[model samples]
Target: MSKKVAVLVAGSWGTALASVLAANQLDVIMWTRGEDQATEINNKHTNQRFLPDAELSPRIQATTDMAKAVEGASAVLIVAPSSAMRSVAHQLKAHYKPEMLIIHATKGFETESLNRMSTVISEELECEEGRVVVLSGPSHAEEVVKRCPTTVVVASLDKASAEAAQGLFMNAYFRVYTNRDMIGVELAGAFKNIIALGAGMSDGLNFGDNAKAALLTRGLAEITRIGVEMGANPLTFSGLAGIGDLVVTATSQHSRNWRAGSLLGKGQKLDDVLNSMGMVVEGIRTTQAAHFISQKYGVQMPIADQLYHVLFQERQPRDAVEALMGRDPKTEMEVMTLETWEQWHS
Candidate 1:
C-alpha cells in the first residue's frame, strides 16, 4: 500500500510538490487555506492561479478542511509561507499524531521570532527533535512539476528522518540527498532569499552581468558567515541549499525575490511591487527576519543589512549598493572566519 502524504500549501510551489508526490504514486492530499482553491484542485484537477499548464494527478485530492487533510496522513509536508507556519501548526496541534513525519519545504524565517521553518514547526507542534526534516535546494516549482531534473537535500538531525524523507520524494529526475545539519540547511535556505534580492537589485540597476555575479558570490559569503555563527556547518553552504539556491533564485526570472528586487531597483515602492505580484514575496519578510538575526547575533551580514535598510528604511537601492561597495576594504573572509571561530570558542 502507498503511504498517504498531506501537503499544506496553496501556492504554485505547493502544487508542484503535490504533483511530484502523486506522480510517484503516493496518496497525496493537498490542503489549501481557501475553499475556492480546494474546489479548483478537487474539481478541475488544476490549480489555475498557480500551475495553469500542469495537470494534477487524479490520485491527488484537495481540501480546505485541516482535519480531513491531516487525518491518516503518514507524512505531512509544510509548504506554507513562513509567516503562516505558526498558525497552521496551532491548528494541527489537536490532530497531531506521533507517527506523522513532518517535512518542511518552506524556506523562510519567522520575522517575529527569527526562527527557522523547522524550528517553528517543532516549537508549535511539540515535535521530537529529529521528527522534523527540511527539504531545500535549487529546485524551482515551475520546473519541478514538469518533471525537469532537480536535486534537493533532505536534512534532519536524525539519519532515519532524512532517509525516510528521501524515500518519499526520490525519483529518476528528482534526486534526494541526505544531510545531518538541520541548522545549516534551514539557515542556508532562508538567508539565500535575502541575497537573491541583492542580485535582483543588481539586475534592476541594469548593472552588467559582472555586478550580478559579484553580488551572488559575495552574498553566499555573507550567508555562510551567518550560518556558521548560528551553529550550522559551514560546508553545507557550499552545497545545494546555500550556493545552489542562491544562484537559481538570483538569476532566474521565476524567483519572487529577484522579481521584487528588480522592482525595487527600478524605483517602484515595495508595497507597489508586492501588490503587483499578488503572491507572497517571501524575501520581504525574510529580510526583516534575517536583519533581526544579524543584529541579534552580531553577524556582519552586509548584504542583509543593506537590503533591510533599503526595503524597510526607504534607503535608495543605488545608495545601498554604494554604501556596501564603499565599505572599508579588508580580506573578503577576514571578518567571516574570525567571527565564526570566535563564536565557536565562546
Candidate 2:
C-alpha cells in the first residue's frame, strides 16, 4: 500500500500541498468543512474557488468527515487558517493518533493567547510540542500547484520527524529542507507577512525601490531582533524562512498580505480592504498579534508599530510612512545588544 497522508481543510495552500503529495504517489485524503467543496474535489478534481486554473490529480481524494480523513493515515497535515486552527485541531482530537506525524503549514499566531500554530496544535492534540512540525517558506499556493520550482523548510524539535516530513514532501519541483530551530522558523514565517504588508503599502504609496528596499532590510533586522529575544536561533532568520520568505512575500503580486497592504496604501479602509480580499490576509491579524507581542516583550518594532497604527488607528498610510522616516537617527547595526551577541556566539 502507498503511504497515506491526511490534509486538513481545503484551502488553496492545502489543496496545492495535496497535489504535491499525489505527485509523490501517496494516498492523500483532504478534509473540508463544506460538503460542496468536497463533492467538487471528489468529482471534478478541481478546487475552482482556490486554484481556478489548476486541475487536481485523480489520486487525491476529498471528504467532509475529519475522522474518515485521518483514519489509518501515516501523517496528518493541518492547513487550516490561523484564526480557525484551534477549532480545527480540536475537531481532529477524537481521530488523531499519537504516533501520526503531525505537521502544520499554517502561518500566523493565535491572537488571543499569542501562541504559535505549533503550540496551538500541541495544546489541542495533547501531544508533545516537539513532535509537531512546521512547513513554511516563500512558496505560494498558486505557483506550487502549477509545479513551479519551489523550496520550503520543515522545522521541528524532533530531528527524525523533520526528516520524515522532508522525505514525504520533497520532489522534483518542490524542494524541502530540515531545520531544528522550530521556534526561529515559525517566528520568521509569521513575522515576514507584516513586512510584506509594509512593502505593499510602500509600493501603493508610489515609493520607489529605495523605500521598499529599506523596508525589507530594516524589516528583517527588527524581525531577527524579536526572534532572537524569543529564544530563536539568530542564524535561522537569514535562511529560507527568514530573508527568503520576506523577499517573496514583500515583492510578489501573489501575496495576499501585499495586496491588502496596497489597498491600504491607496487609502482604502481596513474593513473595506479585508472585505475585498475574500481570503484570510494573515498579515492583518498577525499585525495585531505583533502589536501585543512587541509590547509584552518590550521589543522595538518601528515598522510593525506603524502598520498597526495604519491598519487599526486610522493613521493615514502616508503619515505612517512619514513617522517611520522621521524617527530619530540611529545606527543600523545595533539590532542586537552585546549580551545577545555573546549568548549567540558563545
Best by TM-score: 2
What TM-score, over all chains together, does every model reach?
A: 0.96, 0.99
Which lDDT tens digits does candidate 2 get at residues 212-268? 999999999999999988999999999999999999999999999999998888888
How would you encode candidate 1's per-residue C-alpha lDDT over 1-346 as one tens digit per residue? 2379998876888888888888789998888778898888888888888877788889789898889888899899989888899998878888888778889889898887787888788888897767799999998899998999999999999898899999999999999999999999998988898988888888999997999988888888888887887889888999998888888999999998999999999999998999998888888998898888888888788888999999999999999989999999898658756656775557
Q: Which ten residues in a row have the lowest lDDT in candidate 2?
A: 328-337
lDDT of predicted model 1: 0.88
Off by over 4 Å in 1: 338-346
lDDT of each: 0.88, 0.94
Residue 277 shift from truth in candidate 1, angstroms = 0.8
The alpha-carbon lDDT assigned to residue 7 of candidate 2 equals 97
